[model samples]
Target: MSWANILKQYEQEFKEAEVNSYTELPDGKYTVKVETARLKESKNQGIPMLAWEFVVVDGEYEGRHEWKYSLIMPERMQWLKQDLFSAGLELEELHRLEEELPSLLDRLLEIKIETKMSKNGKEYRNVYIQKVVDRTPSQKPENPFSPNNPFADDGKPINISDDDLPF
Candidate 1:
């Protein structure tokens, strides 16, 4: 689709009935709430997505919408988390199915909404109606005690005594 139409469509979907609020993202780690959706082809099975939708809920571009990402369900969302972080968002700020996403998505699957954005390159959004599966990380068994240094477990932080030195 043409960028003109694409932009216009997003403008409508994200329109706040004609109101916009902006906030500056301070320089630091942050969590920006996002709304996501996914879509798939009617004829394809177990096939990768046709696209996805992602919406920003805060900051300068609050209410901005994207509908051209490649994310079809039933699919995993770990990568989505990564991409969101890359796009200046964190899971700390999320609303799933419009009901607070981070926790909700961790517990159940929600149908998401997304829109396609490009003709050639891959750029899309998880429309508000896309599907999201439980994406919480599993808790690993804790060791009896903390190691001296995590890096030392890999030997990088290990000290080399005089004889151990590879000089």
Candidate 2:
């Protein structure tokens, strides 16, 4: 098909209504689920760190995400240990961190998130997982990204096949 003809056919489809982007949640204590947790290197300090992405599961900012990073090296182990303890993991040894941290994904916890201004006077937010909450006997945790999950509505997981692409 000619480029002009293709463009003409899809012109109306491309003019669909605009969707609003997610805004930062207000600074407060909220219940959140661990959306993603992984070990990553710090770009500035060149140290290994545990990076976590948490999603609010309730209230007005239900689907918003917040990030938290805990440095895992010897010099920063104290803070790292505290964060782990707050997340319901009590570890006295550094070696066990790597083996157990990944299991925290999808776990729900109450967290205190605060917004603060940096040295440059720009505002940003930080999340601190305060405590891990236990699920009721009849309830089970669900993945927000799963097809059947209730929170997956606005942020639906798209599955695009290779053949569906134009190029």
Candidate 3:
């Protein structure tokens, strides 16, 4: 189909679809689940770093995501160790992070997030994992971000067939 025809067909959806934009969360404690984790090289220095994307599991901001990055350096190990331990992944060797990173996914924890503005007028967030929360496998949601989810972005209920019900 031509671009014009395609746009015409989806014009209503384009207007109604919500834009997924980035907005800093307010400074407060939040219960989040680790959605993704990886070890990557830092942009500038090429230093190894553990990067994480955490999804808010509940509350007013449920389904919202925030990123946390920890550089693997001697000076930064203290804080990294503390955060990892809080997430229930205690490690004696830092090199073991790669093997353990995948385990962080689906782990639930209480995180304290704070937004700070630098002198240059840029804003950044600090994510601190306060503690790991107990979550049985039965309580886990399949995929909160999936389009077929029965809950809308605002947490309102969406129409679904009886087959969609877990029970």
Best by lDDT: 3
Candidate models: Cα lDDT each: 0.42, 0.81, 0.84
For 4-77, candidate 3 gives per-residue lDDT tens digits of 98779888888999998777888999989888889899999999888889899899999999889988898998
Clashing pairs in 3: none
Q: What TM-score does prediction 3 earn?
A: 0.67
Which should have the higher lDDT, number 1 or number 3? 3
Candidate 2 residue runs with Cα over 4 Å from true position: 1-8, 43-46, 135-167
lDDT of 1 by residue, 1-167 (tens): 98998788678567667665653322222122334434344455555443434444445654554444544343546655554444333457434322322332212223334345688977554423233333443345544233445445653445557996588
lDDT of 1 at 129: 26
Regions of model 1 farther than 4 Å from truth? 1-32, 42-47, 71-167
Model 3 residue 6 lDDT score: 71
RMSD of each: 18.4, 13.5, 11.2
Please provide TM-scores, in order, for all candidate models, with all chains considered together.
Answer: 0.24, 0.67, 0.67
Segments of candidate 3 deviating more than 4 angstroms: 1-21, 117-123, 135-167
What is candidate 2's lDDT per residue for 26-91, written digit by digit as tens? 789999888877888999887889998988888988888888898877888777888888888787
Candidate 3 has its poorest 10 consecutive residues by lDDT at 134-143
Better of 2 and 3 by lDDT: 3
